[model samples]
Target: MMRQWGLAFSFLISAFSGLASVPPDAAAQDRPAVSQCQAIARTLPDVVYASFSASDVLPAQARAEAVRITYLGHSTFNIETAGGVSIVTDYNGWYRPAATPTVATMNKAHSTHYTLNPEPGIAHVLHGWGDGGGPARHGLVVGDAYVRNVTTDIRSGGGVMEPDGNSIFIFEIAGLCIGHLGHLHHELDEGHYAEIGRLDVLMVPVDGGLTMGAESMSRVVTRLRSSLILPMHRRGPPITAFLSMFDDSFDRSYATGPSVTVSLRSLPRKPLIHILQGV
Candidate 1:
């Protein structure tokens, strides 16, 4: 009880002191001029995404204009930018792709989403949890991407809850704000939406019961209203249930291969649900 109050007090102080770090010019324009509340009030929603053909995988010539997202099974995705930076989401010890990543973001929902020991050669390993300290804080630039996180609580066990146990990692690359909801456990609050700002593409968990219920997850996805939605962290039954909630208005398709590259220009006018195989 005391710890919870202390954490609340800390948040209040941080809010009052204006302890926000300086964001990029794009972020500054979209986000509120304060910490915690990063999203700005917007009147219109814009669609932002791009894609490449299956044969275009890892072209020798670096395409600095588009972002490539390769599904490496489960909740892990290899996000490659035009400048040769690579990032792996929900990284565990298993399921490493051919190329090592420049950065790895992890969450503590389960062993499948995180690893105690990561590769030595990896440059950055961002943990979702605060290592029992506080919420994990990450705001760094690597090559062509800017990475940050917004923390949320998780169900520990026996109905107990642990605050700041998970993080929603946002990758700003190629003029797109790509968000990965790592082991999400609840519906987002107003503060979370504000901090998340506007997401162009979103990777969400649809396990129905593990991370959150399909209905609730669907509501959260609709609330974000990103251009593209990539489903992960579940098998067929849950994925099917999650998909049933969205009607024909959403563009639904499965990737031909294990990867799909997207940029701002290739985004659909309406929302899309992309199911990548091998997961």
Candidate 2:
């Protein structure tokens, strides 16, 4: 039954993509600004999972149209889009890909989760917190991707709740909604979920202590239920402990390398916890 549903969904998405591929002059005037992923979420209550094996490498041509996600260790991920856009999530100074990204996002929960000075040649730098008293605001479109943010609170040095201190960045690219939960310190409310929309791939902080506890973070994972869950900010026992919470419901895959290429049509059929190489 589930298999049949997945096939149908894939077919429908393929047809939708065909229509979307029409020249911009033909559909630009009629197309809505809302992302394709969010539109699907609004119409379909449940996001049917698609099929892709993380271990299978694709040919160069197919990979050119896909998004490459590299786990650069310790809460940083370099996300490269097929259209030549590269974004670094939780970009503290130390961990980074060889080439500077087109955009870099940072959070203020800790020093490691952010950096004061990023390397040269980066196109944009988005801070999760605002320089003034207000919350950070980011709605940027570069190449084939649209980047946005939903503000969330964080715990300050005194352990008091600081409102709108963190941002959960969402990257909409290639008909997929990829999100990074940056130094998340609490469970999400309905409003936060609404703003975030649906996430096909989620880069989550699974440290279990500094961000949030295993149990609480597990609840967040259960609620989002992203097709692919990439655990970042990993510490030994917490990674194992967090996976245990979803052992029955989610499939676990340990990728041979630190990077994985994914496309809209290549999402996993079952919810998967994909652990990449390196901490």
Candidate 3:
């Protein structure tokens, strides 16, 4: 898939390099709620309707706790733990130098995965299959955090069409397991759910019908029964569709600032979905 970069993001790729890629597959799953969200994908426009400024973004040096998490745009995010463990997801192009994480993950299915090696430094870089050749690997560890990636096929273009492969990532840090769903083109079944296991926080792709769609994302959330939901990979019309459908009662609200900090001890006992401001 072609990846369109936000203006500020255009600089990092250098004078060459086109974009990243992901593996495709055959996928199809029915989600009643997602059907409702399809309306949003079809009707809404991109989020550029409202302009965002750097002042609105949190300062990079601002402390993020081992318990602190901040959504960078789309599937890209920075998670810093109190004990000095930091991880980022989809190190896609939509982030700045400051937002770059020490340990970042790359999904090979879409434009928003992986990255050119950072000038500062990167502790670990894990590749989600389709981009690499081999049996495919899942599970990683950086400091006190353990990470894993799972793959499933997403059928596109109508009846059982398969394109690129997709992956769902789970990062376990300080006992809390957080999952990030990337360019997922379909819903998960029982087996997929079992593989996903219990999630404390879920980073979802909410492009409505455009990218796996909202209904599908919701279904995963329901089964995973995660405590937090960080909506991503959404802009324009789809965001409206996703937000409209996410009207259930949970300890839900936007985060404190652009990023919300947390630690193992502060973990929630009950499920709560917090929409943190995306970078």
Poorly placed runs, candidate 1 (over 4 Å): 1-64, 236-238
Q: What is candidate 3's local distance difference test score?
A: 0.56
Q: Write the candidate numbers in order of decreasing lDDT.
A: 2, 1, 3
What are the TM-scores, per candidate, against the unseen true structure? 0.78, 0.81, 0.67
Model 2: residues with Cα > 4 Å off, grouped in runs: 1-33, 40-64, 236-238
TM-score of candidate 2 versus the correct structure, residues matched by position: 0.81
Cα RMSD, each candidate: 10.4, 5.6, 17.4
lDDT for each residue of candidate 1 in 132-236, tens digit (9 for 90 to 100): 587888886666577899899999988588999999999977656789999888898876776786787899987887888888998888878788899988854
Backbone atom clashes (below 3 Å) for every candidate: 5, 1, 24
Q: Per-residue CA lDDT of candidate 2, range 204-267, in tens? A: 8888777898889988888888889999987656578888888667999899999999886678
lDDT of each: 0.75, 0.79, 0.56
Clashing pairs in 1: 39-194, 49-263, 49-267, 50-262, 50-263
Worst 10 residues of 1 by lDDT: 40-49
Candidate 3 per-residue lDDT over residues 1-279, each given as its tens digit:
023333222322221121112111111112111111111112232311111112212222211234667777777888876557678788865674374466777775556666665435676777665655443455544444556766766554454645335677777554456778877777776555555555667888776665665677776666666667777777555345665665554456666676866544455655566676651
Ranking by TM-score: 2, 1, 3
Model 3 — TM-score against the truth? 0.67
Model 2 error, position 203 (Å): 0.8
